[model samples]
Target: MSTVLQPGPARRKAARIAVLSGIASVAVALAGCGDSGTPDASQPTPEASAGPSAAAAELVVQDPWVKAADDGMTAVFGVLVNDTTADVTITSVTTDISPVELHEMAMSDGAMVMREKDGGIVVPAGGSHTLEPGGDHIMLMDIARPVQPGDEIALTLTFADGATSEFTAVAKPFAGAEESYDPSTEMDHG
Candidate 1:
């Protein structure tokens, strides 16, 4: 009988399996090292270069008006809306008429009265405040010129945060004049 000269079939099969296992181990090791290499050319950088990082808040003035007065003195009123993430304080007011002074209305001895307020108005974030006749208002004293209907006056409002908003005040007749003059109403007599 002829003897088997080479390795048996089972031994050859085992050798082939060992070679395949070695190749698989090498492939796994290479995959583990891939993370440490330089980044691929197709990938983006770490810093994202787009859009505004911080946006400023907006201040909106609504229905601004100035009332006619004598002795170069007048009253300015409006509604101020703060639509931002920061607190706003009206530090100073400037106008062509004159320096604006903050004023408040109060009752003295059961009589309506008005007085000067040194401190300015504070508007909270995402909130609104009002300056109107018979309330908190801006007093324009020593006007350079006369104001009439359809006249536009520029009022620069300076904020504590160093931001300024310039608003135009339209000259109009006093608000609620009819109600204020009606004889049948309590406000009319007061």
Candidate 2:
């Protein structure tokens, strides 16, 4: 009878398994170390990127900013670009400050007139609405802390379709707004 060699050990199989496990671990580590993708600055963040109560919309907020103010109030300026084929309406604005309102400035009686935007600002299809000083913008009022240059202001823009977009406006010292209108005409939007 031919001499048969008994199975010596499971060492070979165990070694193969160990090598596979090491490869899997290295793969996982590399995946975790990969670089995060870059984002487009023009568009608003997705729901996952933004927090709860935020949804995606066609409007893009570009170069948003809040001018520095002494203490009482300030304004956020930016351009709202609606890239959709249909018109988009921005219903309201909210911020970290106590009171925030959507405002519009226009020349009414040969003088600059500013007031709270009643219904909402409408952005035509494939058009852009500029929220600038002496124009349409978000008014941040009743702020206890003085807004200084390089500060950041958090704000949310609500739409008529129930979608909300969040953005942060950087504070900069601008001078054009001082001569735009009389500061005493500000009224309560309550």
Candidate 3:
């Protein structure tokens, strides 16, 4: 009732060739594709924007990155550049991971506190706004999952004119900027 079958030498060779051919095909398909697994912090992301509008075309996020976090929340830092002769105001930020907020550090009771930015961030005409630790940043609240180093997070910035720009930011470990103004929740940065 049982059958014992073995492939012949030619059949075995053909099977090996098929497997190798599939691997080669995959390699060929992935050739020249971006995302090398390890992101280069110094270089801008190849796929920076998804669908840039007229206003978004003149805007660029340079060297964008996110702080690694196991849970809770994380922040994104980058250099927002405005190439046009008019100032660009980012009204809001949206992402798939969690709620996003434009946050800035302020002196509250002799301490630096993180709070929501009321009027959002503005990149001056032909200038740039640097989002760094303990400064202006894009805050990701209540992350659904862990954001480890080398991970990519996509975010969309809505300008005051209703134009939007999307970009992906790589995650890296950071040890600073752990203070959160909300006493009900703890922030994760390092």
lDDT of each: 0.69, 0.75, 0.82
- Name the 10 consecutive residues with the lowest summed lDDT in model 1: 48-57
* Cα error, candidate 1, residue 19 (Å): 56
lDDT of 3 by residue, 1-190 (tens): 9988899999999999999999999997787366778866775555543223444667999999999888887889999998866778899999999889898877776666678888989888889999998799999888999999999999999998788889999999888655542436433221
The number of the candidate with the highest lDDT is: 3
Deviation of model 2 at 80, angstroms: 0.5
Cα error, residue 112 of model 3, in Å, equals 1.3
Ranking 2 against 3 by TM-score, winner: 3
Best model per TM-score: 3
| Model 1 spans > 4 angstroms off | 1-57, 108-111, 175-190
TM-score of candidate 2 against the unseen true structure: 0.65
Which sequence of candidate numbers ranks them by TM-score, best first?
Answer: 3, 2, 1
Candidate 2 off by > 4 Å: 1-56, 180-190
Which is the winner by lDDT between candidate 1 and candidate 3? 3
The residue-by-residue lDDT of candidate 2 on 73-125, one tens digit each, is 77888999876666778888887674887888766556656778888888877
TM-score of each: 0.59, 0.65, 0.66
